[model samples]
Target: MFKTIKNDLPASIVVFFVALPLCLGIALASGAPLFSGLIAGIIGGIVVGSLSGSKIGVSGPAAGLAAIVLTAIGTLGGYQNFLVAVVLGGIIQLLFGVLRAGVIGYYFPSSVIKGMLTGIGIIIILKQIPHFFGYDANPEGDFAFFQVDGENTFSDLFKTLKYITPGSALIGIMGLGILILWEKVLTKKAKIFKLIQGPLVAVVVGIIFYAITKSNDTLAIAQSHLVTVPIPEDTSSFFAQFSFPNFSVITKPEIWIVAFTIALVASLETLLCVEATDKLDPHKNVTPTNRELLAQGTGNILSGLIGGLPITQVIVRSSANIQSGGVSKMSAIIHGFFLLISVIVIPKLLNMIPLSVLAAILLVVGYKLAKPKLFKQMYDLGWKQSVPFTVTVLGIVFIDLLYGIGLGLGVGIIVILLKSYQNSHFLHIEDKSNGKHKIKMSFAEEVTFFNKGAILKELDSLPRDTYLELNLMNTRYLDNDVIEILEDFAVKAKERHIDIKLVSKRGVVENPESFIEFFRTRPKSNLSLS
Candidate 1:
């Protein structure tokens, strides 16, 4: 891991900057003490990062969990009591790892997964626009359509325009321009630019802007518009920030319910992010999913014990790490150290940076995730792949993360069933002479109950005076449901004046005694179509 320190260190700094506001913002959204988010960030980085198989994925307090945490905290009595659930949740996740439940992550369709990444990217961009323009009405990191502040995502954007702060807009726009220039020009022109990223430069410039405009009334940025890390007046006050879980609530049934909920949700989110991170990894490394669950479980246990929110592998930080060129787990571990040291050694200096600058940085991240070309690409794949992808994107954009994924998966399953119905069997009309028709039907290699409807429809459509040949020449497995349909169709063939020829490995049978009796009397080895 240390071999890539040079690459990881720079990327870690960028992740550190990106993670700071998110930690605080998620905590704010969760209705928990702001410091709890920072603690989870610290543990998610140092503890989980060290143990996780993922080289580039970063774990932390997730925005996805904010709603759950908020409700759990309220129902469980208080934040301290809620910590008990977090700890138990970690234990359950560890058990899930032991049970090899991580395989469930692979069951999600690729279309839905891609949709999630794109949807999240779009959400980040839309949510950050308000912060970028200097309107801080919504707390930073609240990406849901319906925000906790009684305002929706689009409505807040309109509201931001009415009360924009000129200073914030100036710094944010300049910060974005600098980042773009640094990436496109400076990196190629000078070694110094490559060594130091644009985000770090943007932050330094933002701090300077804050200081320069301190005395100006109209151009000055408010304290609320800047990063807000809780500052401790002394060492004791710093230690006081950490809280211990209320162990007395361990036996409560409600506590167990919340624990299971967190375990399930956090594990699922972590596994999804793991897949996303692996896909985004430049080396295409596959992380061991079960180990990741174990690592996250351990991180959550320690975090809850010390009064931190539940932890999950978050895509935003992981994507930023990958985009910033993180090459190893060292990036994630080092970023955690940066978070710890920043709050302890330079809390005041950290507080001087503007939230709008961070928003600008995330805007770039968001654009990369939801590039317009991707929409065109998905559309060209045909509706079988495109419909679920489109639904997943819209679901995440308008509803929330989990619901959108569910909707997309639902659509994807329907597409599969439709295709199955269309591909079940092949039918041909061989002869239509005088007033008689000869029809031949061939079953697919493998036919299931889903093929029942199409076969039944064809049988029901047969004309009178037709000669029907039921062919199982290629069938290897015929489901009982389809077998029943064939048996019932044979009985009805006599009434329609249709002469039936049953063909299989058992040889031809003319007007078989009974479909079920013929099958029951046939030898097992001769049952399959040759």
Candidate 2:
């Protein structure tokens, strides 16, 4: 792991810059104390990264959990009380890992998973646009369709025209230009260019712009448009910011309900992020989901104890890490250390880093995730893969993360059923022999009841005077309902002047006594069609 320090160090700097404002923003959106977000960021990085099996994945206070935290804080009476729920939520996640519930993440369709990453990319772009132009009404981490700032995602874009800050927007455009130059040109020119990433450069330029333009009203970035980490004057004041959970509220039933909700949602988000990050990883490393849950649970427990929000594996940060060339978990660990040390040391300097620069950084991340080529690639794969992918993207862009996934999963299942119905068998027709229509129908590898409708239709549509062959040579598992259907069809064949033959690895049996018995006694084999 240490061997990749050159890569991990630079990646960590980029992730650190990406995570700082987000930690504060999510905490702001959650209505928690600003410092709490930093605490979660720190714990998520150090504790979770150290324990996690994932190399490129990063954990932090997630935007997905912001609303949950906001509601729980109010419903549970106060911030201190809410901490109890977070702690309990961590416990519940630990239990989930022990129960091996992490396997649930594997059940998602590939189309849906792709849709998720693309959808999140689009959301990131949309969410950052306002911030990019220095319209700082919404928190940087807000990813939902509807905003806490009384604007929907698109509406926010339109609103940006009315409040764009010239100074911030100028710097944002400059930052974007620098990122493009570094990524598209400079990095290929020299090894040193790779070490000093574009995001770090953009942030430094943003700080310099803020510093030098302080006297210029039109070009000077406003304080509201800059990073706002809580600045402590001394060590004691910094330590005082950490809040301890009010454990007395642990006995409340409402607290437990809140805890369970947090655990379930956070685990789901983490699992989905794990899937997305692993796909993005250049190394194609697999993360142990159960272990990830354990790491997140441990992180959350520590975060809550210190008055921080619930933690999850955040796709934005993880993807940024992967995109920035993170090779190991050390990148995540170092970013946490940065969060820990920076707030205690150079928070005043951090405050000078304009939000627009960070917004520009995120915009690049977003563009990569939702690249135009991906759309064509999915479309080229055909509707079976594309439809759910499209629906998931639309749902996520129009609704929210979990809702989008559910909608995509539902569409994916429908696609499966449709394909199942259509693929029940391959039918072939031959010239009439002995004044009878001859047909051969080969069953699929696995025939389930979902295919009953198609098979029944094919059998029912046969000519009155016909000879039909039921080919089981390549069929593996035949459903009882389907076998029963064939049994019924065989009975009706006598009246229609249709003769039926059962063909299997056991050999052909003309007018089998019982379709069900014949199939039950037959052996499945890799028999090629003749």
Candidate 3:
């Protein structure tokens, strides 16, 4: 891992810059102490990063958990009480890893997963737009369609337009320009540009801009529009920033309920992000899913003990790590150390970094996730893939992350069912000879009761005085209901003056004794038409 430090170091800096504001934002959104978010970020990077099998994935305090954290904190009576739940959640996630529950992430459809990434991308761009213009009414890291402040996503954007801060907007525009230039030109033109990333430069520029504009009354950005890390006056106060869990709360049944919820949700989000990150990884390395859960469980346990919010492998940070050329988990570990050291050493300097600059950075990340090319690519894959993809995107943009995923999964399942229905079998009619139509119907690889209606309709529509061929060559599993249909159809075919020929691996039979009897008598391999 140390061998990759050359690559990991620069990538870590980019992730550090990206993770800083998010750590603070998600904490603010969760109604937890801001320092708690940094704690989670640190543990996620150092502890979880060490244990996880993923080379490119980054773990941190997830925005996805902000709502749950917010509600759980209130419902459990206090932040200290909620800390108990976080610890318990970690224990449960460990159990999940031992049980190999990581496989659940594999069941999510590709369309839904892509939709999720795209949806989040769009959300980041939309939510950050307000911050980009210095409108900070809604706290950072609140990505829900309906914000806790009672304003919806779109309404807030409209409101931001009315209260745009000139200083913030100017800094944001300049920061974005620098980022774009760094990616498109500077990185290619010089080695130095590759060493110091665009986001870091953008941050430095933002700090200078804040200092310059402080005296301009009309153009000055408010402190609310800057990165806010809790600054302890001294070492004693800094040590006090860490809070212990109220272990007494563990006795409460409600605390366990909250723990289970966090475990279930955080595990799900982690698994999904792991999947997305692996796909984005240029190495195409597959991370051990069960191991990831164990790592996350441990991270959350540590995070909770130190008064941190819940932790998960976040897609945004993971994607940033990959895009910035992170080659190994060292990047994540380094980023964690950055979070640990920076908060203590440069809290005041960090506070001077404009929120708009970070917003500009996220805007780039968002654009990459929701690229126009991706939309076109999904659409080209056809409705089966596109519809669910579109629904997932819309649901995420208009609803919260999990709900949007549920909606997309529902649509994806419907598509699968519809495809199953339509693809039950294929029917072909040969040219008529001597007033007798020759029809061959082939069953699919797996025929179930869901294919019953379509198969029955085709059988019933056979014309009189025809030779009907029932082909089961490709079928691997034939449902009993479908056998019953063919058996019943055999009897009806005689009445219609249709001669039936049964084709199977055994041999072609002319008017087989009974469809069910023939199948029962033959070996499983012989029962399939060849």
TM per candidate comes to 0.95, 0.95, 0.96
Better of 1 and 2 by lDDT: 2
For model 2, what is the error of residue 192's alpha carbon versus the real structure, in angstroms, after optimal superposition?
1.6
Instruction: Write the residue-wise lDDT of candidate 2 on 315-363 in tens digits.
Output: 9999999999999999999999999999988989999999999999999
Best candidate, lDDT: 2
- In candidate 1, which residue pairs get closer than 3 Å at backbone N, Cα or C atoms, i.e. clash? none
* Native-to-model Cα distance after best TM-score fit, residue 8 in candidate 1, in Å: 1.7
Compared with the true structure, all predictions reach lDDT values of 0.91, 0.92, 0.91
In Å, residue 415's CA in model 1 sits off its true spot by 1.2
Candidate 1, 99-161: lDDT as tens digits: 999988898888888999999999999999999989988776577889898889899889988
List candidate 2 stretches off by more than 4 Å: 519-530
- RMSD (Cα, Å) for all candidates, in order, is 2.3, 2.6, 2.0
**Cα error of candidate 2 at position 459, Å:** 1.3
The TM-score, computed over Cα atoms with residue i paired to residue i, of candidate 2 is 0.95
Judging by TM-score, tell me the better candidate of 1 and 3.
Answer: 3
Residue 478 CA displacement from its true place in model 2, Å: 1.5
